[model samples]
Target: MMDAHRQNRLRALTTPVVLIAILLIFVLIVTATGDKSLARMAAQTLIRVIFVVGLWIFVGNSGVVSFGHAGFMAIGAYCSAWLTLRPQMKGMFLPDLPPWLASAEWPHLPATVVSGVLAALIALFVGAAILRLSGIAASIATFAFLAIVNTVYSNWEGVTGATSSVVGLDRYADEWVTLAWASVAVFVATLHANSASGLALRATREDEVAAAASGVNMYRHRLLSLVISGFFTGVSGVLLGHSLGVLNPNSFYLGITFITLAMLVVGGIGSLSGAVIGVLVLSVLIEGLVRFERGVDIGGASFALPSGAQEILIGIIMILVLIIRPSGLTGGRELRLPVLGWRVRHSKQEPQSTN
Candidate 1:
């Protein structure tokens, strides 16, 4: 009995273990190749992992599609810029700042954490009202939230630079730094998915009427998931800003919102492993398309795709995936060890037969 239980526990661990190992291997290969562009691509991929997994915490478990998360990301990116940028630079670009925020300069690490916390708090506040709705209504509400955020940031001349890009941020988010955060995101996501709230929220997803009958507080669970989701999504934003050494309101708009959603839907929004896998697959394809646009050298001639072909191609691929496998590439399942699962089932059968 104990042995069977141990096997089950080990089986439960296989998904995250495999995911983290995959990331470590990817980094090792990139480092061995010593390609700066590959490293940049890897860093961006990790950032997407963090953001998509954060989205998974809410959308995967609660079965709610959100278009507003990028808004939280915008908040975090700008918050990090406000905190980390030098006081003198802030004064130069953002002259109408409050004395405390204007004069302050913070280190990157703390700024990242605080940025996430601020985004989470905002999620909690907004989710209190938004999570009460269900289905398409809820999705629309989230989209509205994103629009509001974008508008505010675009017009907030004194604080967010009013459509102008905030520059001079330190480009400190390299591959290793993003890898650490991605690992943390996977860990936190796993922990949340296995929690009681996660389970209850999923129950609500499967059947809202039945779950409510079973005493599952859908609102609370959904709200909790959103808070957690907002945190990592916000952190991803900070990483993006630090990596590029720039921040702009437009960066966190519809383009990113749709692509991340496409990653989630394509990778299997119903499964955690799907989130990570989706990011890797799409990021690689996008990078390849970018290279093609830049003109790849063939045996004797340079071949290049037309600019903007990547988006159209990606959209077609997404449509094909949806039509072929609506549940996503992983079909909404975690990575599991078949042998361990068999052993566990066999062990239970053995005890029943002995009795």
Candidate 2:
């Protein structure tokens, strides 16, 4: 029995160990080669990992799909951009702004935090209106929210530059910043997943009527997840805005929303670790494939994919994953370390059992 328990412990630890080892290898490769470009790519990928993980927080736990996360991200990007861009530039570009917004020039960190707060507030308001819906209704409502936000940002020139790109923000993102934010996001998500509220949310996901019968307020739990997801997604937007040093309303358009949703779906909508791995794998593939030379030879012939091939590839992958592993790679399993004594005893017992 002890040996069986040990084997279980070792099995539990294997996934996490492999993931950590791979992460460390990636870091070492980027650092040792002095590749700033690759490092930047890695940083951006980590930031996005946080954003996808945020999606998992709500959609994974509650089993409610959301397409409005991009709206929260847009809110954060614009808020941070407005706050941190030079005052003089704002005066030129957005002269009709409110006195407080026009007068203040915030540092990057404070601006990022404020952006997150603004997104959270918006999410709270929206959640109150939409969380009462079930299944497809909720999903459609969230998509409508994204459309509304996109329209507003596109037409609201004074605040969002209308259709033009917003420019001239300080660039302050690096690997350390990306990793720190990702770690915080992971910690928060894990805590929430293990919390009482999380349990209630999960119960709601399993059976809303049953959960309600048990006195679990489904709306309240769903709202909580939405707020948390919005907060982290907002932070991700800040990182993205800073990393790019420019922003555009169109950048957060439906294409982006679809791509993100695809990532979550392919990674396993029910699994957080699956979400992270899916983002890592897909992001790398998409970005890396784009760098291939135009005339590369394949099967004795020269060929190159079109500019938008990555998106197509992602869609295909999503379909395949859905068909083949609908539960996701990890199937909602968490990575954990093994107990050494358990594994050693299990190994010894395995030989005796074989004899």
Candidate 3:
């Protein structure tokens, strides 16, 4: 019995453990190559993995598609920048900032935590009202929220650099840094998926009316999921800014919003495994397309795709995937220990036979 309990515990952790192992191996391989470009791509891919996993926390469980997480990312990026930038730099570029923020400079780690919390706070506030409305209405509201954030940041010259890019940030978030965060995101997502709120939210996703009848507080669970989702989404933004050493409002706009969503949908938005795998698969394809656009050498001949062709090709691939496997690459299932699953199946059958 003790052995069985221990096996059950190990089985429960299988998903997150496997996901983190994959990320670790990916980083190790990239490091072994000693190629700067591949390392950079790996870093960016890890960031996207965090973003998609964060998105899955809400969308996967709630079955409500969101278009506003990019805005949360923008908020975190700028907030971390504000906290970490030199006082002189902030004064020069963002003279309009409050006195405390203008003079304050902080380390990246705490700033990351604070930025994530702030993003979660914003999500909590916004979701309180938005989650009240069900279905498409809520989705539209989230989109509107994103647009508002973008417009405000774009025109807020003194604080966010307006239409200009904010530079001179610390570029410390490399592949290893992002890999750690990606692991954390996967672990947190796994916990949430197994939590009561996550289970209830998924129930609501399956049948809203039935869940409500069963006494699941739909609004509460939805809001909780969104808050959790916003935190990691925000942290991913912080990593993106630090990795590139620049912050731009437009960087967190429609392009990232749709691409991340595409990754989640392509991977199987209903499972945490799908979120990570989707990012990996899509990132690799995008990287390959980018290399092709730069021209590949074949037997002293040059082969190159047209500039911007990658986007079109990726779009086509996503469409094909959706057509063929709408449930996503993972089919809404997690990575589990196969033997453990088999044992559970046999156990159920054994009980049936006894009856």
Candidate 4:
């Protein structure tokens, strides 16, 4: 007879375990195939897993839409570049950086840690000012934050290279590295979701007035979740910089934001399993379409999707998913291992109020 606490822990553990298993299989098959392109795609998918899970930590629990995470991501990427680039290169490329930054260099892991912490700190302050707002206004505020960050990063030549892409970053975030970090992201998100604050935040998400009346500190929980969310979001950005060996403000802006949010929504915003599954399904779909765009042969006949068809098709898929299953593909249920005798459970919905 397992204790209730122990049983709950086992259930929570299954989602991450299943995800790790899937990633292991992906890496093994790709490596065994000796296909470098497939290996690269696998690495990219792992990174997206990290990004989507990070968003889930904040958006799913708080039931708030955030368009501002990309700003923190940009901060993280540029910050990593400042720390990891050789002093000589920094001085040459980012000449206007502060003397200490221009003359300092650090390894990827340490730089990533520092970048996450800095982004979290920024979120703490920003959330303090904005998390008080509720509903659509809060969503609009986040969009404003993203716009402001983009404008500054796009024009600030001294630090972010303005519109030019910053290069020379070490390509250290390979498949294994991204896999490890993506695992960490899931662990962090699960732990947070199981914590007291996460529950209190979700309470507010269900009914703000009821939660506040019940003594939940809505503002505090929202701010804490935002800070935690910013941390992982920033780490993902550091990984992005290393993976691509460059940084561009525009790269972290609209395109990445839309795809990531789409993944989260398509996966079911209420479950961690949804976040992981969404990334895997969409990544594979997009990759397949990309290959088809290059051309495909079926039954000895050549076929190809036009350029940009992948984007258009993905958009259609997202719309159909939303129209057909608004609760998402997971129906808001978390994944569990059958060997554990645990069944996936959907989130309980609040009764609709006619008010």
Where does candidate 1 have its weakest 10-residue lDDT segment? 346-355
Write model 3 residue lDDT over 167-279, tens digit each, in one string.
98999999999999999999998888888888899999999999999999999999999999999999999999999999989999999999999999999988899999999
Give the TM-score comparing model 4 with the true structure, all chains together: 0.93
Please identify model 1 stretches exceeding 4 Å from their true place: 3-10, 337-339, 349-355
**Mind giving the per-residue lDDT tens digits that candidate 2 earns over 83-186?**
98888878777666787888789988889889999999999999999998989999999999999999998888887887878788888887678777877777
| lDDT, model 4, position 189 | 90
C-alpha TM-scores of all predictions:
0.95, 0.87, 0.95, 0.93
lDDT value, residue 158 of candidate 1: 87
Model 4 backbone overlap count: 0
Worst 10 residues of 4 by lDDT: 341-350
CA RMSD per model (angstroms): 1.9, 4.5, 2.4, 6.2
Whole-model lDDT per candidate: 0.92, 0.81, 0.93, 0.88
Clashing pairs in 3: none
Q: Candidate 2 versus the native: TM-score?
A: 0.87
lDDT of 4 by residue, 1-355 (tens): 5555666677777788887787778778778988888888888888888888989999999999998899888888899999999887777678899988898888778999999999999999899989989988999899899999899999988788899888899988889999999989998898898889998999999999999999999999999999999999989999999999988899889999989999999989999989988998899899999999999999999999999999999999999999998988899988878756443222123345697
Off by over 4 Å in 2: 1-25, 293-303, 340-355
Residue 345 in model 4: lDDT: 27
For candidate 1, report its TM-score.
0.95
